[model samples]
Target: MNDSLPGYAERLDALHQALAADFRAIIARLPWREHESILDPGCGDGFFTGLLAERLPRGVAVGLDTSTAFLEAAEARLAEQIEAGRVRLVEGNVDRLPFDDATIDGVFSAHSMQSYPDLPHALREFRRVLRAGSTLAILETDNVHSIMLSWPPDLELAVRQAEHREIGDEDSYIGTYFPRFAPRLLAEAGFTDLQREYIFIERQPPVGEALERYVELYLKYLAEQTSGRLDAAATARLAEIGDPRSKRFLPRQANFFFGSLQTLITARA
Candidate 1:
């Protein structure tokens, strides 16, 4: 197992549990074919892959991920589907797919494109493997679009700016450029009929435990990432609010609210 697999899976599971309804709704919105094969590249743990398989009762969901550990976890999660022959998890890289050209009927990727070693090369590979007129759907979000807590807007803005200044070009922050570049990149890669949608999820006080836990983890991540980038007072404030045991924990505040926006872009090959 990868050294970070436990933490990575926990964070993904918490987020999935918290926003499960929205995630299902988004996947349900896609146009599915009952007898066509769909490729889910970068399908870690098969969370979204299982949903894709559910939509295609008679079709197959081919999940391709680079990590053997992640594929093992995905296999365990989708054991029933795998036995039914509706889902298949493979160890492979997105940019250099193992399949022949133009063999896939459709492709669905989520929150993983930003991590591709080469964005342009991966986009071409997606186009190459997809049949003519097949759809490619990608769901991604920027740090600015992905989070909104009930804290002060000024502090949030400061943290956002700090993140951009520090690691904006890193894979973790690369999603920030997707909204602006995805269309052109897809077009350049020989895809057509591009479209985009913004999905919003929000919750108020009395939110679920999953959401609360996700928020706590996200806060801690933000605090860790911007530890020395922000001013001393701002850094201290983030630490206090991020700590669940602290009196200033924001999740415990009255009228606490949480919201996020994810961008979904679909293109035809």
Candidate 2:
């Protein structure tokens, strides 16, 4: 777990609890079965990995990530299960997963793959480590499209400016993040029986501690994105956007494209 991610972890935990029922409803439609070993790539802080371990059959869950901070946090959260030998955690990058070829039954990632510098290389690695008939599920935010749709005009401009100032590449992190044509990627990776689905998760306004944490995370993200070059004006504008008392309420709904999260049912020739 990166020290940077714990705050986001707290926010997501709040999200999981608040939306547990809805999340379960969505998971119910996923094709999971008993005793199938699953790999959670980029298993940040182990939240989703713990969820899968609890839901899937016993003794068949593994979490792999690059952040030592996250792996430590994940181990702590799943300590009891680890003691019982029901879960395993490994720290490694997705582009060079530390696993044997054709070993895993399935793979799952959420809101993490977009950070990879080389998407195609990482996708190829995903295809490499899975068994011939294994599956891979990826969950990522369509930040480009989603932000444009949901953010206030002023806030959106700030985000764009911040992007330009920082990366000099508008799509640096989010370019091709969602895999709009997931089947094409799967096909390129030699996957078959490809199916994709889009799920819209409506996030209500954050409240109390959760809201505070959310605002902080947003600010921190902007600060990092701008490399602290975010001027006083941009900082002030972001504060306004996050002000709980402001009339411009945060968008009540966030459309999270789930196709990337649900693709790759099995490998192919």
Candidate 3:
């Protein structure tokens, strides 16, 4: 996927507002002190990493991700902060983090865990890097299945069809239902003091440029799923269905799974 599209950065920035707010809420409840270190696994664009740096006093914040494109964007977005020696952006995968055991005080990841092929391996890595009693905060979207159900009947059917055509392989694109089983996974990873909280945000209807960008991305993903099987005529029909002019009849709803599940995990050496 092209991460450098013109409006992509802006759209991601808007989305990060909600993400950063949730992270702030999570941090507010935790007992943090000066000079502690935190890792943002899958820190796309480093928006939350910057937020963490601002909130922590004399602390080190690192943003890690597998995508070099995203890491570069993050570095650029956080250049001023980086030059000030507040944040670090590293290119790495979550399953194999580049950090010493017991080196970090906390791990925060959002919206990316669902794409991992081996979630348990990633969770183990998070467990291995944090000191004993360190906290981990994960925020991700629920299944596309759940999302489809929340839409209007006509729109839901359209989205479901698009998704069905898009899943080329079940093992390859195992979307975001991982959080539903997070409690069990945390226990398996030797984490204690587990808690889960669900956060729901009212959907703000996209307008003008935002709506245009949203529809374009949605159709782009849909096209990828169909893999050119959806010819021009079919594509045009889907576009008509997703038209913002009809948004009043088929409103878009955004539902995210924000888990404030905190657990004390053992660090490996």
lDDT of 1 at 241: 83
- lDDT by candidate, in order shown: 0.85, 0.63, 0.63
TM-score of each: 0.92, 0.74, 0.73
User: Which of the two, 2 or 3, has more TM-score?
Assistant: 2
Flag clash pairs in model 3.
Answer: 166-225
- lDDT-better candidate, 1 vs 2: 1
**Per-residue accuracy of model 2 over 1-269 as CA lDDT, tens digit each:** 12545546765665455445555665445566767778888887787777777767564679988788888888999998788776899989977889888888777766665667876677788888888766677655565533223455666676677666534453464334455645666677677876556566544443345444454455456556765556777666665555556554343224311111222223342
Please list all clashing residue pairs in model 1, or write none if there are none: none
* TM-score-superior candidate, 1 or 2: 1
Query: What are the per-model numbers of colliding residue pairs?
Result: 0, 6, 1
After superposition, candidate 1 runs with Cα above 4 Å error: 1-7, 167-175
What lDDT tens digits, residue by residue, belong to model 3 across residues 120-159? 7888898899888777876665655323213345544554
| Model 1 residue 54 distance off true place after TM-score fit, in angstroms | 1.1
What does candidate 1's lDDT look like per residue over 1-269, in tens digits?
44236555777788988888788899888876877899999998899999899889999999998888788889999999999999998889976898999999999989886677688789999999999889999988865667888987788888888877855354544445577688778999999999999888898878878887888888888888887889998988888887789887887888688888888899999
